[model samples]
Target: MNVVITPHTLQGTVEAPSSKSIGHRDLICAALADGESVVDNISPSQDIEATCQILQAFGADIQEIPSSHPGRAAYCVRGGLKRQDQPLSVNANESGSTLRFLIPVGILSGNTVTFHGQGRLAKRPLAPYYTIFDEKHIAYTTTDGALPLTVHGTLRPGRYALAGDVSSQFFTGLLMTLPLLSGDSHLQSTTPLESASYVNMTIDCLTQHGIQIDKDWNGSYHIPGNQQYRNGEYVVEGDYSQAAFWLSAGTLGKAICCTGLRPHSSQGDEVIVSIIRQMGGQIEGKTELTACPSLLEGRVIDVEDCPDLVPVLTVLATCSKGITRIINAGRVRLKECDRLHAIATELNKLGADVEEEPEGLIIHGVSGLTGGRVSGWNDHRIAMALAVASQRCSGTLVIEGAECVRKSYPEFWQDFASLGGIYRQED
Candidate 1:
C-alpha cells in the first residue's frame, strides 16, 4: 500500500504498542514452559506471529484470549517443541529476530527444519549461527545465504565462541538452546560485544522463565544443563523503538504523550528518550513518556547500543539546528533493508540533507524538509520513520509500501490518525 500524507500539526495521545522485543522472548518462553503460561498485554504483529506460529507448528498449544489491556491480546501457551521424524518448515516473514531465535530451537528439537524468509530477509546474513553449526558438526545447507536453509543433527552443549560485533540475535539463539542441553555450556564472545543490552534482555527473559544464566566479568555467558521453563504470567511492556517515531513527531509538531512504557526498561532502544532530550526536545516522564515541540540542537548520537533508533533519529537530526552525526552503526546494513542507506536515500529524496557513511549517518539540520514521494524500502522502521518525518515536510509526502508497518506495529497507521495525521491510502 502507498500512503500520501499532507503535512499537518500532530498532537494528542497514542498508547505505545507492546514491545516486540519482549513479546518475542515472552511468547517463546511461555510456549516452552513446562505448563500453561499466560503472555498478557501482547499484540500480534507479523513478526511476533511468525515466531508464535512456528512454535505452534513445533507442538506448542497457543490460544489467543482477551488481553489485560484494550487494543491487545493474550496468549495461553502450553506444551513445548517436539521432535518429529520428518522435517519442520518455518517461515520467518522477513523478521530477522524470529529467524535467528528459532534456528537453535529447531536443532535442539531434533528435527530437520527448513527455515524460509520473505523480502530482504533471505539476504540477511546468518553467518554467526553458521559458525556454531560448523564447530558443532551440525549439517546445514543454504542457497548462497538465501532462505530455505535446512539444518540437521542435534545440538550438544559445550564451549562456544561467537563474534560479539556481528548480530546479538545469534547469541540469543544459542543462549536459549544451551540451557536445554544435557551438559553445561559456555558461550564466549570473541570480540567486544556491541548491542550487549539485547543479550541482557535475552538473559532477563530466561531468568523470568525460571532458568539461570551466569555472566562473567569478561562478558561471557555460562549456562547449566537440564533446565526447565516454568510457566507463569508475563506482561509485555510498550515498545521503546516504536515510541521513537511518535516522540520524534512530537518534537517536530505538537505535544504527544505515550503511555505503557516500562520505566528503566532493559530495552536498549529506550535510549531514544534520552536522545530526543539531548537534542533539546521537551520530553519527560517514566511510566508515560511525553514529547513536546522544541527547537532541537544537533548533537553527536551513538548507534553502538541502539542501531534501531538511527532512522527516526536521523529524521530528528534533519530538523535539528546544526550538524547531527550518528556514528557506530554498520550493522544497520544487515537489517530488513540497509537502514543507513535507506534512511539517507529516502530523506534526501525529500530534500533533507542526509549523508550515508560507511558506519553511520551525518545529517545537516535544515529549517524544514521539502517533501515528495519516497519508497518505504520494505522495512518497517524505514517506513515509520518516514511517516514521522512527514510532519516536518513542507509538501505532501507519499510513502510507498507504507503497509510494511504491520511487521512490528500493526496499528501504527490508526495511531498515526489518532495523532491527527492526515493521510490517504492507495492500492
Candidate 2:
C-alpha cells in the first residue's frame, strides 16, 4: 500500500500500543507455565501473532478474549512445552524474537526441529547459539548462519558462554530455556553486555512467572535446575518504541499527546522521552506524555542500548537545529531493514541533510523539509517515520509500501489520521 501525506499540523491524543518486546516475553513464559496464564492489554500485530502461533504449534493451548478497551485483547495460554509426534517445522515469518526465543525450546525437545524464516530475518546473526551448540556437541544444521536451520540433540545443562555484544535475543533464548533443563546452568558473558535492558526485561518476565535467576556481579546469569513456570496474570505496558513516532511528530508539529506508557519501563526505547527533551522538544505529563514543538537543538546519542529508536530519532534530528550525531547504531543495519541506510536515504530524498556512516548517522538539521516520493523499505518503523516526517514537509509526501506498519503497529495510519494528519491512500 502507498500513502500520500499533505503538509499539516498534528495535534490530539492517541493511546500507545502494548510493548511488543514485553508481549513476546510474557507470552513465551505463559506458554511454558504449569497452568493457564492470562496476558492482558495485548494489541494483535504480526510479530506478536507470530509468537502466539509458534507457541500454539509447540502444543500450548491459546485463546484470545475480547477486552472492553478498544485495540486490546486478552490471551489465556495453557502453558507447556509439549512436543507433538508429527514432524515439527516452525516458520518464524520475519520475527527475529520468535525464532531466537524458540530455538532453545526446540533443543529441549530432543527431537529434530526445523526452523524457517522469511525476509532479512534469515540473515540475522545466530552465532551465539551455534557456538554453544558446537561446544556441547549438539547436532545442528543451518543455511550458512541464517535460518532454515535444524537442531536435534538433548541440551545438556552446564556452563553456556555467550558473547555479550551480539544480539541480546541469544542471551534471552538461553535464559528462557535454562530453567527448563534438568540440571542447573550458568550463562557467562564473554564481554560487556550491550542491550542489557532487554535482558532485564526477560528477567522481569521470568520472575513474574515464578522463575528465579541469580545475576553475578560480573554480569553472568545463574539458573537453577528443575524450575517451574507458575501461571499468573500479566499486563503488557505501552510500547515506547511505537510511541517514539508520535512523540517525534510532536517535536516537528503542533502537539501530540500519548497515553498508556509506563513511566518506569525497562524498555530501552523509553529513552525517547529524555532524548527528545535533550533535543529541545517540550514534554509534559507523567503517565500521559504530551510533547510540543520547541526550539529544537541537535545532540549526540548512543544507540547501543536502544537500536529501535534510530528511525524516529533520525526524523526528529532532521527537524532540529545544528548536527545530531547518532552513534553506536551499527546493529540497526541488521534489523527488519537497514535502518540507518533506509532512514538516511529516505529522509534525504525529502531534501533533508543526512549522512550515513558505517555504524551511525550524522544529520544536519534544517528549518524544514521539501517532500517527495519515498519507499518504506518494507519496514514498519521506516514507514511510520516517513509518515511523521510528512508533518514538516512542504509538499505532498508519497510513501510506497506504507502498509508495512502492520508488523508492529497495525493501527499506525489510523492513529496518524486521528492526530489530524492529512493523507490519502494510493493503490
Candidate 3:
C-alpha cells in the first residue's frame, strides 16, 4: 500500500490502542488458569491473534464476547484444557515473540509440538533455545536454527542456564513455563539479562495468575511446581509505543491529548513520555497527555532496551537540535526488518543527516526536512514512524508499503486523518 502525508496540524484527543505486550502475557496466563479468563481492551493485531490461536490449540475454549460499545471487544479463553496426547502443529506466522513465548510452555503438554513460521520467522534464529534443549537433553531439532522446529519434550525440572543478552523472550518463555513443570525448577543465567524491564512484566503477570517465582538480583529464578493460575478479568493498558507517533505529532501542531493510558504502565515504551520531557517537550498528565509546541532538541537517546522506540524516536531525532545517538539496539536488526538501517535510509531520503551503526544510529538535526518518496521496509513501526515524520517535514512524503502498520495499529492512518493529517494518494 502507498501512503503520502504532508505537514498537518493535529488538534484533538485520541485514545491509544491497548498494549499487545501485556495482552499476550495475560492471554497465556488466562488460558492456563482454572476458570474462564476475560481479556478486555485487546488490540486486534495479528501478533495477538497468533497468541490466542496457540492457546486454543492447547485445549482452551476461546470465545469472542460481543461488546456493547464501539470500542474493542472482550475475549474469553476458557481454562482447564482437556489434555490431548496427539502431536500439535502450531504456526507462529511472522511473530517471533509468539514462537519464543509459547514453545516452552507447550512442552508442558507432553505432546510433540511442531512449529512452522512464515517469511522472516523462517530465517530468524532459534539457536538459543536449541542449545538449551540440547544441554538439558531434551529432544528438539530445528530447520537451520530457524522455525519449523520439532520438540518432543519430556520436560524434566532441572537447572537450565542461558545467555540473557540474546533476547528476553527466551527467558520469558521459561519463566512462564517453569512453574507448571512437574517438579521444582531452577533457572540460572550466565549473563545479565538484557531488557530486564520486560522480564519484570512477565514476573508481574505470572504472580497475578498465582504462579510463584523466586528471583534474586543475581539473575536466578526458582519456580515452585504444581501451581495453578487464577482466573479473572485482565485489562490491557494503552500502548505507549503506538501513542508516541500521535504525541510527537502534537508537538508539531496544536495540543494533542491522548486518553486510555495508565500513569504506571509496565510497557517499556512508556519511556517515550519521559524521553520527550528530557528532550525539552512539555508533557502533562498520564491519562491525558498534552504536548506543548516546542522545538525538539536533544543530544543523545539510549534506546538499547526499547528498540521498538528506535524508528519513532528517529523521527523525533530528525526534528531535534544537535545530534541524537540511539544506542544498544542492535537486536533491532533481527526484527521484522533491519529497523535501524531502514529508518536511517528513509530519513536520509527525506533530506536529513542520518547515520546507521552496527548497534544503533546517529542523527544530526537538520533545520528542516523536505519529504520525498521513501520505503516503509514493510515493518509496522517503520510505517507509523514515517507518518509522524511527515507531520513535521516540508513537502509531501510518499511511503511505499505503508499499510504494514495494520499489523499493530489497524486504524493508524484513519486515526491520523481524523486528527487533521493531510495527504492524497499518488495512484
Candidate 4:
C-alpha cells in the first residue's frame, strides 16, 4: 500500500500500541509454562501473531477470548509442547525477532523443525546461532548461514558464553530455552551487553511467570533447569517504539497527548522522550502517560543498543534547528532493511541534508521539508518514520510500500487520521 500524507497539524489523544517486545516474551513464557495462562492487552500484529501460531503448532493450546464490550480481547494459552502429527515446517514470514526467539525454543521440543522466512530475512545471517548450536552440541543445519534452517535437538542445559554485541535476540533465544533444558544452564557474556534493557524485559516476563534466572555480579544468567513456568495473567504495556512516530508527529504539529505507556518502562525507547525533550520539546501532565511538543534542537545521539529507534529519531532530526547526529547504529543495517541507508536516502529525498556514515548518520535540519515520493524499503519502521516526517513538509509525501507498518502497527494510518493527520490511500 502507498500512503499520501499531506502537511497538517496533529491534535488529540491516542493510546500507544502494545509492545511486541513484551508481548512476544509473554507469549513465549506462557507457552513454556504448564496449565492455562491469560494474556491481556496484547496486540494482533503480524509479528506477535506469527509467534502465537508457532507456539500452537508445537502443542500449546491457545484460545482467543472475545469480550462482550468493545475493544476487549484476551488469549488463554495452555503451555507445554506436544509432537505434531507431521514434520513441523514453521513459516516465520518477515519477523526477524519471531524467527530468532522461536527457533531455539522449538529446538527444545525435539521436533524436526524446518524454518523459513521471506525477503531480507532469507539472506540475514544466522552464523552466530550456528556456532552456538555447535558449541552446545545441538543438531542443526543452515543453507550458507541463512534461514531455511533445520534443527533437531532437546537443547540440553549447560554453561555457555555468547557475545552480546551483534543482536540481543541471540541471547533472548538461549535465555528462554534454558529453563526447558535437561540440566541447569549458565550464560556469561563476553562484552558489556548492548540493548541490556531488552534482556531486562525478557527477565521480567520470565519472573512474572514464576521462572527464576539469577543474575550474578558479572551479569551472567543462571537458570535452574526443569523449573516450569506458572500460568497466570499478563497485561502487555504500550510500545514506546511505536509512540515515537506519534510523538514525532505531535512535535511537528499542535501539542498532542499520548497515553498507555508507563514512565518507568524498561524499554530503551523511553529514552526518546528525554532525547526529544533535550531537543526542545515540552512534555506536560504529571501522570504516567502524557507527551507534548517541546523545542527541537538538532543534536547527536548514540543508539548503539536501541537501534530500532533510528528511523523515528532520524525523522525527528529532519525537523530540528541544527545538525543532528545518530551514531552507534551499524546493526540497524542488518534489520528488516538497511535502516541507516534508508533513513539517509528518504530524508535526502525530502530536501534534508542527511549524510549516511559507516556507523551512523548526520542530518542538517532546515526550515521545512520539501516533500516528494520516498520508498519505505518494505520496512515498517521506515514507513512510519516517513509518515511522521511528512507533517512539517512543504507538499504531500508519498510513501510507497507503507503497508509494511502492519507487521507491527496495523492501525497506524487509521490512528494518524483520528489525530487530525490526513492519510489518503493512493495506489
For candidate 4, the TM-score is: 0.96
Relative to the true structure, how large is the alpha-carbon lDDT of every model? 0.90, 0.89, 0.83, 0.84
How many residue pairs in model 2 have overlapping backbones? 0
Scored against the true structure, residue 242 in model 2 reaches a CA lDDT of 93
Off by over 4 Å in 3: 81-85, 424-426
Instruction: List where candidate 4 sits over 4 angstroms from the true fold.
Output: 67-72, 286-288
**Please, what is the TM-score per model?**
0.98, 0.98, 0.96, 0.96
lDDT by residue for model 4 (1-427), tens: 8888888878889888888899899888898888888888876788888888889888898888863323535788989988766779998888888898998888877688999998898988777688778887778888788879989876777788878877888888888888877689898887778888888878877888888899998899899988888888888888889887877777877777788887788788888788778888876652234456656888879897578999989888878888999998988999998999998898888888889999899988887889799999999999988888877788988999988988999888888899988878895
- Per-residue lDDT tens digits for candidate 2, residues 156-234, read 7899998988789999989998998899999998988889999998998899889999999888999999999989988
lDDT of 1 by residue, 225-308 (tens): 899988989999888999999988998999999999888888999999888888888897888888999999999998899999
C-alpha positional error of residue 141 in candidate 3 after TM-score superposition, expressed in Å:
2.3
lDDT of 3 by residue, 1-427 (tens): 8977878777788989888788889888888888787888886888888888888887888898965325685797788554576888989878888989988877776768888887677787777788888887789877567778888766778887888888889888898888877789898778777887788888988888788989966778888888788899888888888888888878766788888888876777888898998898878886888776778886678776677888988888888998998889898898899888899999898888889889988999888788789998879999888888887677888999887877788888888888888866668
Cα error, candidate 1, residue 388 (Å): 0.9
lDDT assessment of candidate 3: 0.83
Error of 4 at 80 (Å): 1.3
Where does candidate 2 stray beyond 4 Å?
Answer: none
